[model samples]
Target: MANFISNAFMIPNDLIDKGYMKKMKGSALPCYVLIVRNTRGWNKTTDSMSISQFVEQTGYNKDTVLKGLNTLEELGVIAKKSSKNRASEYTLTDSIIAVDFLDSEKLDSEILDSENGSGSEKLDSKMGSGVENLDKLLSKNSTHNNNIKTNTKTKGNFSEEFEIFWNAYPTCKRKSDKSGTFKTFEKYTRVISLEKLIAILNAFKMDSQWIKNDGEYIPAPSAWLNKKHWENDFWLKAAGLVEQQPQSAETPEYANPQRRHIPTMPKRFKGMNA
Candidate 1:
């Protein structure tokens, strides 16, 4: 029985007849196919797509998708135009590229002759370059991700820090949102240094607002962090007092007019400047 496909789209015979397939040896082939599907499959002359969309559809990384698109552009297989803050618009040069897994092998003389020496060597070289490029992309991506991982504390370490903070918070009438509080703790510490945040937490330990009636009115840790209570003055002083501005050393004169001294007319006003 012959191979058959029912749910299909058309692929331009020129795609094979003109030998564009041979030049699109590596990442470019799949990228072109993706474009074909989006444009020709949808029965539209043009469609917009992004690197992310190609990555998702083809399961290729960003670099691979970019390389494929570049190759297709260079080959004049597609026309791509950038749209600001949107996916690039793509126009497939070929009109009928949607075929049901058709035997492209039978249609191409070079592919049919691929079993012979010269054709086989070219295919190998083309595939070799593809693999090499893919490896390089993966290596670079891994290195970048590793560098970020080095600076970031692991989840286990973060959880430990959160446990310490949770223990130090004042016990209230009822606690809530332990999991959510952990999340807020991460964000809170990002803006307010953990050292200062902890200091504020400790200061609020004996705060009248937090401790009145045995911590009855104290908010949950998540709520407190969300409200940014660490910015409150209650945490800055020994007795939950608002910090006071330093007073000037100069003495303030009494405001009472009764205390004013009457100079005896400056001793007759110096006799008119005698």
Candidate 2:
């Protein structure tokens, strides 16, 4: 249901000059394949798209489009589900090639450290001043830390079942509903503009190399977008899109009595204007 456009949808003109079409085997890149990829961007999610919708959006013949969809499925780049009554939707099968799902080792250590003071403790410490509730949730249930299991093959590659994280929350705010916390594990889509995204990444000190898939670039998930407001605002101001607000006496933590610095009076005070 979320907004998405697949990178595969864009068919570059160079594909023609490079003989990519002639070299493509098995019907040599069908018309619908071109149409569908064009209609969808690399970052689009498929839980909402129907075949009829695709046809309508791409202006491709139903049969031809279906054939191309099947071809893409066979290529193992997309997975299709069959339904008894409603039309099936497609999901990208390119997760491992794109997002770097956090490894179990990292998750385990981070969870444990946050609870009992171990791996990413510093990050938790920073959050403690502003987000005490989050600190409590993260540090609670000490017993859960003992179950440390590591998976060699899983290298933190998120499962297909975890796709909801990308579209579930806004990049700047984390909220909750009746379902509980919104933490999700999934590959991120890289649909947001590169400039905005890179600034977010730089704020979190996360490497952007994960977006490279199969020697090509792909869309990343919104999760990779850092949630720090001031950091993002700094970058936004630098881009000339908005003005950055300077830190003032009214700043949250800095304004507190515990953080305020005592002023040193001068030995000789200047008289007020006579």
Best by lDDT: 1
Worst 10 residues of 2 by lDDT: 178-187
Q: Where does model 2 exceed 4 Å of error?
A: 1-44, 95-274
Q: Give the per-residue lDDT digits (tens) of candidate 2, residues 153-176.
A: 333223222322322222332332
- Backbone clashes in candidate 1 total 9
What's model 2's TM-score?
A: 0.25
**Best TM-score goes to which candidate?**
1
The backbone clash count of each candidate, in order, is 9, 16
Candidate 1 clashing pairs? 9-98, 9-99, 10-96, 10-97, 10-98, 11-96, 11-97, 11-98, 12-96
The true-versus-predicted C-alpha distance at residue 151 of model 1, in Å, is 55
| lDDT at residue 205 of model 1 (Cα atoms) | 62
Candidate 1 wrong stretches, greater than 4 Å: 1-6, 95-274
Q: CA lDDT of 7 in candidate 1?
A: 25
